[model samples]
Target: MTASLEAKAGIRRHAPAASRHAYVTLVTNDDYARGATALTHSLRHSGTQADIIVLHTPALGEASREALAALGCRLVEADLLPLSDAFNARHARRALHGAAPFTKGRKPDFHTPLDNFVKLRLWQLVEYESCIFVDADAIVLKNIDRLFAYPEFSAAPNVYESLRDFQRLNSGVFVARPALATFAAMQERLDVADAFWPRTDQTFLQTFFPQWHGLPVTFNMLQYVWFTMPDLWDWKSIQVLHFQYEKPWETNHPKSEVLMPLIALWQAFHDGGPIPDIAALPGPSGPAAALSPSAGA
Candidate 1:
């Protein structure tokens, strides 16, 4: 078998056995490929021993794939979910955005609603016993290997603006087990007639596992909490910082001024520079300066 095939089959040429757990992230384009690179750097910086896996679509260029491979990230080519044409049409860029506009923050032009559903392909990776799926736009602040012990379908609540926002789960970071049965089950419920997922994979995953275990918010701390809920912004406790809406890579985006501090943090990881002390990083001025009234997916 080829080297890539052997790795997928859990038969590494050097190691006695491949790690049963891995950190998985997705990249569809060059923008997200940059995010994935930084995420891998941060994961290595945190001293994680598990494998780093980057699942990319065909849209990603060869340069991006080579960059990720240089960082010791196992590359897997993931295809968009095989849904009916009607389902894909419903979630197309313009259609989904028109039906459910993002009033709080501007989603970058490259953000495709259908690309989000590709996350579900993680389930098809049955080679790994367990996996922690973190969004490409997020960086690991601390070693979170302990998350592997957490049960399947465990994710942090979507809390950014207020306590009331905890009603839903955030798929930005979650622990899941790899099982073909589960993958098949998700496909069964994903594309029924008139079936619509407003938040794409986030909504569908939440529905697929209604009784999902709730991880502490610190595990997947959303960037908005820095301003909207400053009281909850404990840098020392945050394990992962997720740039949920406005990515740090964008130049002079709408919320650039407000998110400069967080953006700087992401840049440090992306550039492989000396990371600043998390505890010493300044917090928001106050809750009064809350930028957006609503939370994003």
Candidate 2:
């Protein structure tokens, strides 16, 4: 059966609520395949018992699909045709002169084109009683069974603090329960707000939750040296370590040395060599001489 039909059958056979809180990831592009695999491996390695699913947009060609399938993951092809209007940044952000009643006091707006598709996937998958959304760029360092216990709309602080007034929360990780009313309100705000904030999904999310009730800073730790000094976080105690910037594929980031195991695995796959022992990674040297885009530092 096609993926859609299979998904429908599964949904009917086992209700989302029956599974309660599940964990899901969005990997809309083929380039993100390695990150997706690492995410799944790290999660299972740490003993997460929740359902794990990856949402794929049509752009992921056959090779990408096979690679993901080889990892024994469930895939859902997103309904991109219906979102054609929103898929294109220009049209989606065009100001509508004829204001729809629901858009009162709001202006024509859609978020930056980069990860709006991810926002859509989050909408579709979080219909369960609770759900945890983890960015494909993240790795699970520890078993965070306690994360599921956080209340709806819980997330860690965006270490960067780029947004004003509100402590910007990282969209990279969040724990949410079914809050149909809240989700609807947040979605509407995103669909019609004026183009004034950062062109990032995290900016939209920062506005979604009120300050006092937002999740504590301990949950989703954003790991970027430039955003804040890396030493600020108790790295050993973090629930999720997000490689939010200078990602592994980008080559020669100073912080890449810390995640050498992940970096080396990626290098082995690209070089067609035997996997190197994660422990014996060459002592952080000047960027590898033949720096391929795939060998991000």
Highest TM-score, which number?
A: 1
Off by over 4 Å in 2: 1-18, 80-112, 160-166, 179-183, 211-218, 226-228, 251-297
Clashes of each: 0, 6
Q: Model 2: how far is 109 from its true place, Å?
A: 24
Residue pairs with clashing backbones, model 2? 248-296, 249-296, 250-296, 251-296, 251-297, 252-297
lDDT of 2 at 36: 76
Per-candidate TM-scores read: 0.91, 0.66
Q: Give stretches of model 1 more than 4 Å off.
A: 1-17, 286-297
Instruction: List, residue by residue over 244-275, the lDDT tens digit for candidate 1.
Output: 98899987567766777888899999999899
Clashing pairs in 1: none
Candidate 2, 1-297: lDDT as tens digits: 445664542221122233556666766566566677777777776677776667666566778777766665666666442223443443333422222122211211221234443454455544466677787767666677676787766777665433352365667788766554664565566556344334346666667665524554445655432223434445445556666654566544554545554465544444434534433443223243223333332
